[model samples]
Target: MSLLKKFATVASGTLMSRIFGFTREMLMAAFLGTGPVADAFNTAFRFPNTFRRLFAEGAFNAAFVPLFAKEIEQNGMDGAKRFSEEVFGVLFTILLGLTIAMELSMPFLVSTVIAPGFTSDPVKFENTVNLAMIMFPYLACMSLAAMMGGMLNSLHKYFAAAIAPVFLNFILIGALLLAWAQNYDPLQIGYALSWGVMAAGVVQLAIVWFAVRRAGIKIGFRRPKLTPNVRRLLVLALPAAITGGITQINLLINTNIASGSAGAVSSLVYADRFYQLPLGVVGIAVATVLLPELSRALRGGHMQEAGNLQNRSVEFTLFLTLPAAAALLVFSEPLVRLLFERGQFGPESTLIVSQILAVYGLGLPAFVLIKAFIPGFFAREDTRTPMIFAGISVVVNVTLALILFPRLGPTGIATAEITAGWVNAILLLSVLIWRKHWDYDAGLIRRIPRLIIAAAIMAAALYFSAQYFETYLSRQAGLLVQATTLGLLVIGSMIVYFATVFAIGGASLSALKGNMRRRKKAAATPENTDISA
Candidate 1:
């Protein structure tokens, strides 16, 4: 299948999952709002969620897919299956041990590291620690799921893995509804939600596991051994894991800073959810498909093909990212209100969340671009350089956060993150260019200006449109009215943005349509090999 089509599939699924995730968070807002229990739940949830994202989307995929793809290309299906089983065995064992350790230490972690501010309120601290322990098993399930997902993506079977995340939100929604039906207290609801997270992890893993088996590959467990391939994978994955986990690490740093303020952790969580929808859909979809494709291209010595892919990937990223970023920056308050400001989620929560969301918007494009660039290094198994760059970004993020938090509050934390994102993106791009691994093409140079222009135009329109809807947003308008007004604003902005892009000759309707279509020839696979692989 074409990379464009594969990306669409992954993005489409992610779009669905994010929509479900949106609904799930909306329900949580109604069920708990930014109350102490909500704060506790979000705080406890952050640790597992951070590492899960890295394992599922970043670190594991980076190190595993390229090597897994190479195994298939060289040694065929049998070799690939054997390698996968061995990797799974080792990964599962490690995940189990880690889960146990985290569960044992979650209380200490919550008190000292994860949510130190909650400690001042003994109830909040105790609840967070308890909730965190309940969800700790999710780490194991997600780690195994990541292994399965990497294998599926490497084989070009993206649907099941892509859709697995929906289960997490769906299960949480069900749990919340059930809790409401039972009139469970907020703390009870929090525990229910935590268990729901663990359940979803198992469900996610099972679906992908069956999908792999259905594809005629049976993954079985064996005694963990340090086979040469496993050792090599660990060597590559350890640093890649750390590099790929920069987002989580930065969040941890920001969480440390945000934890000093009551409700700040939950505030960042809710605000980030809005932008993560776009990030997951556009940036992650492209990155998921790009990694294996780049690995194959580079392994076969097709630099031209690899370079062209990188350029198109960047173009695709900016085209979607710019509009989303503009909307977040311009319409963040209304969007936050339209979606979240109901029940116990009052105006104060809306305002604070919107501020963070806007700051987050400033770095949205950088976030997507970083995802686009990282594959160049990972495709060549060069994880350590990105690790160095990530370390620098972390230092920058933490230093800035410490300096700004006292003055600006949670907005300051968001600001540090955006700055760090840009730093990481710039460093990654410079190294890629210096190493002759990547450079911008004319297509990129021409297209980016138009994107910026389109986004600027959209931002102005959205700002004005938001003013029109301000009364509906603020005066406790009914859900339908708010939905309609927000919907119109969104639809109108999109129309203007695309029209501007097309008129400026920044994008081609025909080329985009054609790119979405399947070509008559199948993409070339890596040359079959006889090496042990």
Candidate 2:
């Protein structure tokens, strides 16, 4: 497939997932609100999610996909299939054991690792522990699901893997609605959401498993064997694991600090959900499609193609992310109030969450750029470079958090996160340029100024629109008015951004139209056999 079509496939699936995720978070905010129950649930959810990203999304995929793609390139499909089984066997055993141990030690983890913010409050601390224990095993299911996702991506079947997360949100939303229907306590709704997380993992695993099988790869449990391929995968995975873990360590820090403040963890979580919608849609979709393509291109010694792919990925990410960042900055309050002001979530909670959302907005483009840039390194099987950069980002985040958190509270943590993201992105781009590993073409360079101009125009429009809407939205209005106003702002911002991009020649309508035509032709071409340099 052409890069554009491949990106489209991934982006479409991601869009669906993001929509459902937004729905799920909206229900969660209404049902549980930003209070003790929400705090406990957020803390509990972060535990497994943090590790899941570290292992499944970051370490495992960064290592697994390129190796798997190379195996398919070097030794044919059968050889790659066998290698996947061996790796899956070992991964399954290790993740299962880790999950059990984590679940068993939930109390100590909560007290020492997760809920330091609630140190003085025994009730919140205990609830976080209990909820975390119930949710801990979600890591295993998600880890396995990620493995299956890697395999499917290698086969160029991106839809199933990308859409699998939508199932997760669907199940969680259903669980929350069920709790509401039963008239259960809000805390009970939180518990249901936790269990729903595990259940969603199961459903996601099943979806990917079926997709793998449909692609003619059957995965099953086998006696764990340390095949050469499996050994190599483990070796490659180490740096990625360390890198992903370090990159996410700020979350751990934030959680630790949030423990001391009532509802801080939950407020961060709500804001994070908003940030993640765009990140997951654009950043992750691009990363997912880019890695395998870059890996294949590099292996085939197609340097120019690899460079072009990286450049386009960056452009596409910026195209979507810039407006998203602006929307968050201008509409954070209305967005938060619209989705979360009903039920138990009150105006005070909306204000706090919006503050964090705006702070996170400052970092959105950087975060998306990181997702695009890091794969350029990973595709060359150079995990160490990204690891070094991630380590630097960690230090920056920790230093900033330590300096600011005492005086600024949860917003300080948000500031620290955005600053770290900028540091990482700048370092990544600089290193890539200095090392001559990636470069943009004349077209890409010429269009950047236009893109910036377009973004400026959109930002102005959104700012004025948001200011105008705030007065009407600030009243004791119903959810419909808030939702409607926020929706209009988002729609207006997007329209203005895209129209300006086209008008200013940042991205012409004809150019994009031509891209679609080319994509169809590229997809019709057969796979090449000579993938080796």
Candidate 3:
């Protein structure tokens, strides 16, 4: 399959998952609002969720896929299977031990690391501890699932792993519905949701596990041992894990600092979820597909192919990401109000969340670009450099967040995050260009400014459109009227953006079609990895 086609497959799945996730958040807003229970639930889930991103999504794949691809190239399927089993054995044992230790230390972790501010409120603190302990085991399941997902991606069977995450939202949404039906209190609902998260992890893991089996790699557990291969994976993964988890790391920082204010954590969480829609769909899909493809190209000594992959991925990233960022920046308040300003989520909450979402929107491009760039280093087995850059970004985030939070509150923390994000992205891109690892073709250089212009035009249109539809989007309007008006505004803005983009040569139908179409000759020749064909 062509690279663009692979991206679409993964993106479609991610989009589905994000839609379900959006629904889940809306339900949570109605049920818990930005209350103590909401804060506790978000905090509980954040621990496992952060580690899941750190290990399963980014770190494990950065280290494993290249080596696994190399194993296939040099030693064939048998060698790949053996390598996978070795890593699995060690990973499972470590995750088991880590979960046990974390469970035992849950109270201390909640008080010190997770949310120190909650300590003053003994009930909230204890609830957080209990919820975290129930949910922390999710990390083990997801880490194992991520390993299987890496295998599926390496084998070029992308859909299964891509679709696996949808289950998390599905299970959580079901739990929310049950709570609403039974009319559970906030604390009871929090427990139900935490248990739902734990269940989702198992379901997600099972989905990928079966997918890997169907793909003909049955990864079995053996006694844990640190063989050379496993040892090397560890070395590479430790830093990659940290680098991969940079967003969550920043969030953790924000959480610790923002936790001092009531409703601050929940506000940030809502805003983060809104921006994550674009980031997850575009950024993650690119990273997931780009890493393996780039790794294989570099491994096969196809420098031109590697360079083309990077340039095209950036083009793709900006093409989708820029406009989403524009929309968020221009229409944040209406969007927030439309999505969440019902029930307990009031106008005050909407205003605060919108402010934070707008700030996050400014960083959206940088956030997605990081996904596009980091694979350049990981593809070449250079993890430490990105890890170092991640550390610098963390420092920037910590310093700025501390300075700004006192004055700006949640928005201040968001400003620091975006600043940190841009720093990390610029540093990664600069190193790639300086080292001659990334090649910028004329198409990317030319289209970037045009893409920016196209997005600017769309943002202007959205700004006015929101004003024109102000009455319908206001609280006086019924939910149906607000939803319908918002949908039209979004659809209309998208039409304007795409028309302007294609007309201005920012994006081309012919080029996208050509990239999506598989060439007969390239398909006949297995060694030809030229993505442009």
What do the candidate models score in CA lDDT, each in turn?
0.86, 0.82, 0.90
**Candidate achieving the largest lDDT:** 3
**Best candidate (score: TM-score):** 3
Off by over 4 Å in 1: 523-533
What's the C-alpha lDDT at position 430 in model 1? 96
Give lDDT tens digits, candidate 2, residues 1-533. Answer: 56666778888998898888889888888877877888888888898988988888888779999999998998898888888889888998899889888988888888888887675778777888888888888889899889889888888899999999999888988998899899989778878888888888888988999999999988767789998888888877878876656546778778887677777888888888899888888888888998888888888887867887888788778777887887788778888887778877888988888999999988999998998998888888889988888888988998998788888888999999899999999998999999999876776677777777888788899888877777657646665776677778778888999888887777656545545554433222112110101
Pick the winner on TM-score between candidates 1 and 2. 1
TM-score for each candidate, following the candidate numbering: 0.97, 0.95, 0.98
Residue 478 in candidate 2 has what lDDT?
A: 64
Query: Model 2 off-target regions past 4 Å?
Result: 245-247, 518-533
lDDT of 1 by residue, 1-533 (tens): 66678889999989999999999999899778889999889988888987776664566888889989999999999999999989988888888888888888888888788877777899888998888888878877888888888888888899988898999989999999999899998989999999999899899989999999987789888789989989989988877887888888889778877887888888999998998998999988988889988898888887777887788788888888999999999889888887888888998999999999999999999988989999999999998898899899999999999999999999999999999999999999999999888856766787789889988999999898788768876647877888888898899999999989888877777666666656665443211110001
Which residue pairs in candidate 2 collide?
117-259, 117-260, 118-259
User: lDDT for model 2, on a 0 to 1 scale?
Assistant: 0.82
Report the Cα lDDT for candidate 1.
0.86
Model 3 residue runs over 4 Å out of place are 521-533
Task: Compute the lDDT for candidate 3.
Answer: 0.90
lDDT of each residue in 382-432, candidate 3, tens digit only:
999999999999999999999999999999999999999999999999999
